[model samples]
Target: MMRSACALAACWWLPLSVPAAASPASAAEVLPPVIDVAGSIGIVTDYRFRGISLSDTHPSVQGSIVATHRSGAYAGISAYTLNGFGELGGSNLELDLYAGYRHNIGPVTVDAGLLYYAYPGSSGGSYEFIESYASLSARIGPATAKLSAAYSPPQDGLNGNGNLYLAGEVALPIRSTPATLRGRLGRSSGDTPLTPGGLYHEWLVGADYELGQVTLGAAITGTDIAAAEARAAGARPRDTRPTLSLTAALRF
Candidate 1:
């Protein structure tokens, strides 16, 4: 009786299989590989990097594209307009190339990557460097917390000096809403341009609201660099002053 029931079950499914096999389109259909590509373009009131305005306190345009593989490896490129700061060798364009891998272990996610900063068409000097970074993040209740570190080895572009940056971030999604609140505290040391006077702390508090394919954001960002230090370093007024920024971005 068990054998008879098994045969009947196979027979009952035969008609469904026959229709799919008989259709030429279904028989010859091919599925694409599982790579995902995503990108975003945006405009910000100021191009802030580590709490310093790279765009000289002016509006800047930026965009990025990334492609990810099924095995957790990804590569991306980002480009933005800058204000031709002296430290950047008066370069107006900044391009970043990066690649990384990310994977989840238990409830925590780990990400590690290498990034290259390139300044094309600079009139004064070479302003390019590379850095390696790693981060670990986990979700707690309604928020996600992350800790990250980035280190650049001694290189010619950095005047034979290097830099280190460590930061912690938290992002919380407002319940039943499309808004998310985010904050970060970071410390920079070594011999980076932004921290010319030893090490300084930077902080940011922001919120993002998603509207279909667009996201709107507002944030207050500042640094602990003193006015005298900023003046000696040739930093602009927006560098150490607490400033507000508004941004709009579209993702595809």
Candidate 2:
């Protein structure tokens, strides 16, 4: 759990893999894609990635543009404004370019991909890295569950050390309503300049409601990262504090 990587893992980009429905806001709905080119924009009270706050407890805007093939191949870019972690030594935004393939194996949906985290306008520092990940997901009764793993090899962003993350999530829909309840658990371990030798455990529980093309969300997220370690790594205590966030998003 390097300092830099810790924030990045605050939440898995695909927390509960359910095709077009597996997004952070609709974790329980397993709706397959109905459109080829999808675009979305949203705002979050605090942008926390695997349980760490990346927005310094402030709100942030985020959006993504993705194109998916009927064969399950897709590519996209996602970005958000940032205020902490000295991204690029004080750069205030984070962008990700990613591509991947998804396939159904009987009752299970499998996804594999690569993602590159990029910071613009930061020079003379290690500010970018690539991660590879895969996930397995399936529908179980009235809910869906996912298991995922991500790895980043020794790279400049990681200061020549590797990082690993394992995560799981489950989402259940409310009866006869466009609402969902979701929960997540994850563990991260690694060696890097940010955290030296670090290990962390994190969890989240949340719910979301859909209204036409708009979605509303709220979550309570926390992590078991030691205060001593966080301070030693130059991270704020709020990163490990239980946080409540409200969100709204528009999809098209």
Candidate 3:
């Protein structure tokens, strides 16, 4: 179960909200929670939990709370409050949490924190785990480049588990379309649903368009879950798939 939580957090970090969800109070110039509202909610058209679809089993909801101060110190958190998928014995799903802090040094910023994955229906009987990580971000032209590495040792070997992640994205405006295109790519090591014995290769290509008062965004992510090593190791029913997500935000 703990292993699953760690894997889930990795998904959020990948293409969700960059900077990993900060607090609303921490916004610049005494901003309101509404300022971080978009960052706080990811209405996944398909929220997959533990390599399975939750939008089908449970209307999975993921959100975050962020607080930032003038002193350059900020804290925020992200979590999954429900799952729509059914377990082996037809059990309901639960919630998961990930929170961290960021320290700023001029143009360079650093982040560190832990993630908790919980199994809801089981009376909360020790089905959780923690993932720790460090990340850095810097601005270059019209894009913000970020680098992060996180780790978590296996927990009772039940859920899902993994290792290091190298991911980056570039966000900029398209002069003609009232929209923004954010391109992302990543190389990851450790364990994944597709790669049982080795690391996996993944990439995300998505776009967000803002017109007038509403923001619309869509992304398609592809991953090699069952790598060559997994097949060689007698893995069953190869699982290589694509994940899609869409989000909307209203700014006041």
Ranking by lDDT: 2, 1, 3
> Residue by residue across 1-252, what tens digits does model 1's lDDT show?
000000000000011233444566664344323466667777788777777777778887877777777667878888888774654454577888888888789999888888888877665665677888888989999899999988888886666878888999999999999999999998888765546476878888988888887778888888888878777766654344444434443333
Instruction: Give the Å error, residue 147, model 3.
Output: 1.7
lDDT of 3 by residue, 56-82 (tens): 433445565544433333444555544
- Between candidates 1 and 3, the lDDT winner: 1
- Candidate 3 local lDDT, residue 181: 73
Badly placed stretches (over 4 Å) of model 3 are 1-39, 48-60, 72-77, 81-85, 88-94, 123-127, 157-162, 176-178, 191-195, 211-214, 227-252
Best by lDDT: 2
lDDT of 2 at 49: 70
> Backbone collision count in every prediction?
0, 6, 13
Q: 130 in model 3: Cα distance from truth in Å?
A: 0.9
Worst 10 residues of 3 by lDDT: 6-15
4-76 per-residue lDDT for model 2 (tens digits): 3221111112322466635665743554443366667777877777677777777878877777766677778
What C-alpha lDDT values do all the predictions have? 0.70, 0.71, 0.50
